[model samples]
Target: MKTLMYVFIVALGTLACQQEKKIGYVDNGTVINQYQEKRDVEDKFQAREEAFTKRADSISKAFQLEVQQTQIDARKASQKKAQELMQGLQQKQQMLQQQMQFEQQQLSQAFQTEIDSLIIKVKTFVRNYGKDNGYTYILGTSDAAASVLYGTDENNLTQIILDALNAAYQKQ
Candidate 1:
């Protein structure tokens, strides 16, 4: 028993000296989607989109009514007058189309900017979490790119880091 204890202690010491690095992994999609801030951002954009679509629909209906009225009046007017009315309607349609396109583009850009910012913020949070927790490496995996093929649940930091991140966000 004494000889066995001596060999075990020596083996333990040798293994301690080896200093194996700790590694972990996280599901990027899960972390990003489950984040409160990201959800809020998405909700905000959805509301804005709903409002914009509503307003656009109203404008289109009004435009359609005007077109119908103009068409009715054109039948009783001179040929030259009808031509003038049609030209004006065409120009108005073009302007409305352009304005709607510009507004849509602006909305899309703003949403993308917010999303991009959130992605960077998440990355930084994960990096700091890894460093602070003494993780030698924290691999990220997503549907688009699977950086971690397989990792044990013990080494999975998805919920742990996500909870910390939300707690920090709440503090802010």
Candidate 2:
């Protein structure tokens, strides 16, 4: 009976010596939105989009002028010449439309690729942060769905992690 009592005490002591797990959560939307690197990328993409819009507008205006001139010239042109001009204009319009579509797709693809890569970078940063800070688990919560529905304010690490991430990005 004494040996069993000793064993129980030993077990209790061992359990007491083990540290409790440290856990925290971050707000996913807040982190992504507030992250400086993401903002920078978005700003750069916006500028590119603006530039593309300007060029598209220029192309459209030029095409409109060409159509107006062709219409005026068609009245004085021989029937065959008028037909050729109309066909040429149609072909040019189709080619311009195709080019614009291709450019838009390319821009969209590039933006998606960059955004995907940034998300991966954020995930990696969070993982490394957990490992470095001795976190047993780090949960993510977002407006769409909460991975952590109930955590104390003290356990919310979104701002801390965001600040750290921004600082690291600035150093890069």
Candidate 3:
């Protein structure tokens, strides 16, 4: 029993003495946020939002003008007709607002899906790059600083990975 224990201890020590290799990590979040393509997507979304707001404003102005005209009429039938028009206008506005919200939601989801796909592509690229270059590992540093620190010189592969992604992107 003592001989077996000694053998086990010797084996464990030998394993522990072996060198463990690690690759590098990059702050992916930083790269994505600073990326020109990402900025372009955000700019496009903002432009669309502004256009939708303008359309809503125009509709609102038309509704208000009709309401003012309706209020000036003295006949019961005219007043009733005006009320119906006002109600219809209100319903239209509400529907437009809802449509806008739904579109915004869909756009947000689509952006998220696109960003997710890009992240996956970057990760896969890193993996292949690492394997090809004989790296042991490569990790992503997201927009958050969970795995990375500020002013870190260690494992900062941001530029390397970014270049690889852009190259792949351009090829596609």
Candidate 4:
């Protein structure tokens, strides 16, 4: 029994001497928000949204002016001519509305696609980083949700990963 106990102790010591698994956690929101590339993408999308709004506003203003002119002309024109003019204006308004809606949808879809791509890039970068650094796992936590409930400050990789990601983005 004593020999068996010594053998068990030796086995435990051998297992303890094996390599330790590395694990880390990062704040997903912080990393994504502080990432320079994400900020650049958001800025670019904002500019596009502003430009689209301006163009839409200009078109709407021009249409309003045309409607006002048509009303004035209708007052001096024949009943039939006034009816025709009103119908034309209505058709034009409908076409303009449809065009605006289509453009808005296209812009929204494009932005969503870009954002999805960026998210994928972030995930891929984290995976590669873990593989390269020999991390068994790299959990993510956010204010809205968390994959890791508790981790020591030493195991928090958010800042380090964020800095590396930003550097890589700058090089690109």
Candidate 4 per-residue lDDT, tens place, 6-72, comes to: 9999999999988688999999999999999889989998999999999999999999999999999
Task: State model 3's lDDT.
Answer: 0.73
Q: Could you say which candidate leads in TM-score?
A: 2
Listed in order, each prediction's TM-score against the native is 0.88, 0.90, 0.69, 0.88
Greater TM-score among 3 and 4 belongs to 4
Estimate the TM-score for candidate 4: 0.88
In model 3, pairs of residues that clash are: 28-141, 29-143
Error of 2 at 42 (Å): 0.8
Q: 73-139, model 2: which lDDT tens digit per residue? A: 9888999999999999999999999999999999999998999999999999999999999999999
Q: Name the weakest run of 10 consecutive residues (lDDT summed) in model 2.
A: 13-22
The C-alpha RMSD in Å for every predicted model, in order, reads 5.3, 2.3, 4.6, 2.7
The residue pairs found clashing in candidate 4 are none
Question: Each candidate: what lDDT?
Answer: 0.94, 0.95, 0.73, 0.95
Candidate 4 or 2, higher TM-score: 2
As a whole number from 0 to 100, the lDDT of residue 146 in candidate 2 is 84
Provide the clashing-pair count of each candidate structure.
Answer: 0, 0, 2, 0
Selected candidate, larger TM-score, 1 vs 3: 1
Candidate 1 regions with alpha-carbon error over 4 angstroms: 1-17
Q: After superposition, how far is residue 147 of candidate 3 from its true place, in Å?
A: 2.3
